[model samples]
Target chain A: MNDKKIKNVFIEGAISSEFIGRSIAKHQTKTSIGAHNIFLGQVRADEVDEKTIYAIEYTAYKDMANAKFHDIREATFKKFDLTCMHIYHSLGTVKVGEICLFVFVSSPRRKQVFKALEYVVEEIKAKVPVYGKEIFEDASHQWKVNS
Target chain B: MNLNIKYFGLLTEVTLCSEETVPFSKATVSELLDLLFEKHPDLKNKDFQVALNNEIVSKDTLITANELALLPPFSGG
Candidate 1:
């Protein structure tokens, strides 16, 4: 993983399928990579108090969140043998059934990518300073907490 | 010194603003919380952690940065 600079992993809205496709296409030249694992987090229309969630408005402590993402990336690289890793998270309103998070990891072996992908995703959920406000169909909202 | 305080997640709903500045003398993190609790008493009941200069600090930690953020539980995936 390019350990040169802190990469901003945030996108304004949903992580579109086109963007994800382009990312995968760009890695074709990395011939040494034998396996790639991807994890996409989609928003669910959960019912709370009988009100269905329509979307989630995501917000973040930007500076700190970016710093935390950088730390997580560094830690994951140290713990796993990965060739490359990329994480993209959505900010602003993401409707239900849309992709909100995308985690991609590549390695020379299948097992490394599988283990690295899970570790990276778990670290992001637990350590990132991003908040999601679950907006219901009635326009009311509640803060989402990771279980 | 003056501290730029940022509120995120549910804390913003209680504070009614995302960012503000509060003047304070040199003190510990808990002292700053007392000042904030006085202004927005509801914040005392909200679950959050204080980050000073992008690093989470304990209440007993001395204030060393001009920037601070109150972050609630993370829900990012």
Candidate 2:
């Protein structure tokens, strides 16, 4: 696929449902694939010692985040021979139980699609420069990232 | 000379500010980090990553003037 095939690249204040739905639809058209696997990451309320995580406030260094996302997209294409891939991540603040990241990958067969989707998601989590602030119910917070 | 640096996630909290400028001579990224750590030793043990002009770089990478330095770890989808 051409570079233009990757659309809706953003590290914005927030990611809307419309944007995610459109991304999924865009992949369906690009690939005549029978199967597609999508991974949506949601913020959960967790008890951290004495504090409980009520929500996550996501913040990105915009210029850096965009550059990282672009690099990941190019790398995914080179690593996996697939129909298409689209990645969207939240920027400002995402509350508990809310969606923060949506990764969509499509291919002709279910096996390839599943594997590719997992790889992309794992890479994004490990390499991308996004940060999450876990806010406690009592008003304290902690930054959340992959260990 | 002065260089603008940006901090993210936990680094931001420790520094108490998202961005700041540090006066220094020509130095590598590692050198700059050493100066920063000298001022804020709390960052010495934290898990963080650095970027020079939007690309990830090792701690030993040299940094030039006017480059935006960012310290943030991966948190994408």
Give me the TM-scores of chain B across the candidates.
0.96, 0.86
Candidate closest to the true structure, highest lDDT: 1
Question: Could you tally the backbone clashes for each prediction?
Answer: 0, 0
Docking class of 2: medium
lDDT of 1 by residue, B30-50 (tens): 999999999999999999999
Worst 10 residues of 1 chain A by lDDT: A1-10
DockQ (CA atoms), all models: 0.91, 0.76
Docking class for candidate 1: high
Top model number, TM-score: 1
Model 1 share of native interface contacts? 0.94
Tens digits of lDDT, candidate 2, B17-70: 898888877878888888999988888888777787777888777787466556
Candidate 2 lDDT tens digits, A1-147: 235433445555456678778776766456477788888888878788978898777777767666666777787778777777777787767777778888887777788877788887887777667778888989888777565
For every model shown, what is its TM-score relative to the native structure? 0.97, 0.85
Residue A29 of candidate 1: its Cα lDDT?
Answer: 100
